[model samples]
Target: MDFTPPQKRKAEESIVPMINVVFLLLIFFLMTSQITPPEPFEVTLPVSETLGDAESELTLHLSKDGDVQFEDFTGETAWMRLGGRIDPQTVVKLRVDAALPAPKLAQVMQRLSPTGAASVEIVAVQK
Candidate 1:
């Protein structure tokens, strides 16, 4: 009887195909994902049953306490600063907190009117 050592078996399956598939899935998700810019402040947007498309280069944020915040400015000063920089025909996107009262909303609109903006679009989440 011969006492021979068993030959080592080689791996029959290669993991290269599995790795390629995983990489392909990763690339697919990266391409399909939508990335939104982070807001300067937290805001609770109002919900709407109907959706509308409103796009603008300028955005104004309103807080629950009736305080308006803009790029590096807050309150009345923010509006003033925006008024000078924004064009008269530009559309302003107003992102106001849902908790804000109607009067406050009117006040903001009143203030915005002087800027000569063509229109103000209130941003809201569609339900």
Candidate 2:
């Protein structure tokens, strides 16, 4: 007759590998994700029927108070900075506040004409 206690089981498997796999997946998502930075200034985009994706490196921002912001520059300085970056072939993405008046928008367009913009696309939300 056998009267012996069962051998002790090994301790629970180490969770280090699971943790490593979880970290690896987290890193994969972080690398593969496209994260757009927050806008330097808040804006309420106008609604329109225009439907197309334009990914321009340079974006021009016009606030409801007619403030201008291009990349990190703001106000008159933004305009000057924009001038140096723009050329006849540069596509400028203009994000104007919805509350901004039409006249102000027109004035902006007029001023942009002198910058020799190849094309200026107004960023808007689709209806």
Candidate 3:
């Protein structure tokens, strides 16, 4: 019998389908991801030209209408009630509307004094 040159075998694996499946999985994960909205607050902070760097542990939003809200804290309580039992070592952030009266702001600060709150930082947009 005559012997001829043996043929080379081709690779058995096909990578196209595997690549497509990987891309599909990536897209599915991105679409199914959850996006949460920021907490609701009523205050409109005034702007500042020069702001300092500070880390806020708690945020208190006071609206122009005299409504006060506590954010970044767990539990529901009025501003005055909240001041009674806050950690003294944590920093407090006060975000107040630019239009709010100075007296009201002072009152709010006074209420926060009794709380063991470490220090108060005021945040506002640049005017």
Candidate 4:
């Protein structure tokens, strides 16, 4: 038999490029993805000088027609869900439509007070 050892095959192909492409695709998707959930209904937010992003864990939405919605809840069910989620220190975030009447808003606020929320943050758009 020949004394020479068999010729070695070429080294395994590098996977670095594949890994980079995968990472790039992942980043692209993340950048284009929507982080927040879709609104239950279309709402035109009022303008405010102190506009800020809504980051509250417990969010309540009020439509122009005085419809209240919380997550998948509505009407009395929404209120009950909101009340149950509130505590002595929980700050509830309210997204009220710009066209909502003042009296309707007051009624909502009146209902909210007994929920035991320490504060209510009304989210609005910047001028």
lDDT of 2 by residue, 1-127 (tens): 8889989998898999999999999999999999987787789999988677766878999999888898888988999999999878999999999999999999999999999989999988999
Superpose all Cα atoms of candidate 4 onto the true structure and report the RMSD in Å to 1 decimal: 5.6
Give lDDT: candidate 4, residue 127. 88
Global lDDT of each candidate: 0.88, 0.90, 0.75, 0.92
TM of each candidate vs. truth: 0.69, 0.85, 0.61, 0.76
Candidate 1 residue 42 C-alpha distance from true site, Å: 1.4
Q: lDDT by residue for model 1 over 1-127, one digit each (tens)?
A: 8789889898799889999999999999999999766787789999999979889978899988888887778877887888887787799999999999999999889988888899999999999
Tens-place lDDT digits, model 4, residues 13-75: 999999999999999999999798899999999999876666678999999999999999999
Candidate 1: residue 33 lDDT (0-100): 100
Q: Model 4: which ten-residue window has the lowest total lDDT?
A: 48-57
List model 3 lDDT by residue over 1-127, tens digit each. Answer: 7699789898899999999999999999999998644755656677888786557756777877667777544334766556754786878877788889999989888878878788888886655
When 1 and 4 are scored with lDDT, the better candidate is 4
Candidate 3 residue-wise lDDT at 1 = 75
- C-alpha RMSD by candidate, in order: 3.6, 2.4, 6.8, 5.6
What is the descending TM-score order? 2, 4, 1, 3
